[model samples]
Target: MTTPVLYLFGSAAPPVADVAGVITDAQHRGFDVCLGLTPTAARWLAPQLTELERLTGHPVRSEYKMPGTPDVWPKADVIALAPATFNTVNSWALGLTHDFVVGVVAEGIGKRIPTVTMPCVNAAYVQHRQFERSVSELRSMGVRVLYGEDGFQPNQPGQGHPSEYPWHLVLEAAVEMHQG
Candidate 1:
C-alpha cells in the first residue's frame, strides 16, 4: 500500500522555525511529505532548503511553475498549512492566488480536498475584523481550521515562541480529517 501524500504548506510566521520538526513528525506518522512555502517563508527558510529537501525527498516549492510544466510533487491526499500567517489566511479566504502557497491551498479547497490550517497569528492580528471572518469562511468551505483556544490561541503581539507552536496538532488534524 502507498503512504498518504501530505502537502505541507507554510507561511512566514514564528512557528515556521519548527518546520523541519513538523515534517519529521508527519513522516513518523506515515505521511510522505511535500513542502510548499509562501515567498516570505521561502526567504525565511532559505538557509535550510537543502536539508529540508533531503528530509522530505522532494523539492521545496515557493513559486508557480511555467504553464504546461509538469508538477514535481505528487498529488496530495491531504494538505496542512501550519504556521499559517494572518495574511495567508485572509488571502485564502478571499480567493486570492497571488502567491504559490495561497494559490494551491485555494485550489485545494475548490477540489474539496481534506485540508487543515493552523494559524500562527498574534493577539494584535487576531483582533482584526477580518481574521474571524476568514476562519469562518475557511471552515464553511469544509476546510478544518484549527484556531481559537483549543487549537491556536493568539499570543501577545511579538511574544510568540516558535517552540510552543502546536506543530503536532496540525498533522493530527489533517490525518483525522482524511480518515473521517
Candidate 2:
C-alpha cells in the first residue's frame, strides 16, 4: 500500500520547535511527511532546514512556487497545521493567503482536502473577540480546528509549556480524518 502523504505545516510558535519529532511520529504512523512553514518559522528552523529535508525526503517549502513552476511536493492526502499561531488562524479564516502555509490551508477548504489545525496561542491573544470568530468561521468551513478544551488550551502569556503542546492529538486527528 502506498503511504499517505501528510502536509505538515507549522507557524512561528514555540511548539514548532518539536516539529522534527512530530514528523518522526507521523512517519511511524505510516505517513510520508512533507513539511511547510510560515516565513518566520522557516527562519526559526533555518539551521535545520537541510536536516528536515533529509528527514522527510522532500524539499521543505516556505515560499510559494512561481507561476508556471511545477509543484515539487506530492499531493497531500491529509494536511495538519499544528502550532498554528493567532495570525495564521485569523488570516486563513479571513481568506488572506499571503504566506505559503496559510495559503495552502485556506485553499484546502475549497479543495475538499482533509485538513486539521491546532492553534498555539496565549490567553492574551484569545481575549481578542476576533479570535473566537475566526475559530468559529474555520469550523463552519469544515476545517477541524483543535482549540479550546478539545485541543490546545491557551496558557497565560510568558507561562506556556511549549513542550506540552498537543502534537499527539493533532496527529491522531489527522490519521482519523485521512482514514475517513
Question: What lDDT does the true structure give each of the candidates?
Answer: 0.92, 0.95
lDDT score at residue 9, model 2, on the 0-100 scale: 99
Q: At residue 159, give the lDDT of candidate 2.
A: 99
- Give per-residue CA lDDT, model 1, range 26-114, as digits (tens): 99999999999999999999999999999999999999999999999999999999889999999999999999989999999878789
Q: Which pairs clash inside model 2?
A: none
As for model 2, its CA RMSD to the true structure in angstroms is: 0.5
The alpha-carbon deviation from the true structure for residue 44 of candidate 1, after best TM-score superposition, in angstroms, is 0.8
Q: Give the TM-score (vs. native) of candidate 2.
A: 0.99
* Runs off by more than 4 Å, candidate 2: none
lDDT of 2 at 36: 99
Q: How far does residue 76 in candidate 1 sit from its true spot (Å)?
A: 0.3
Q: Please give the lDDT score at residue 138 for candidate 2.
A: 96
Top candidate on TM-score is 2
User: RMSD for each model, in Å, please?
Assistant: 0.8, 0.5
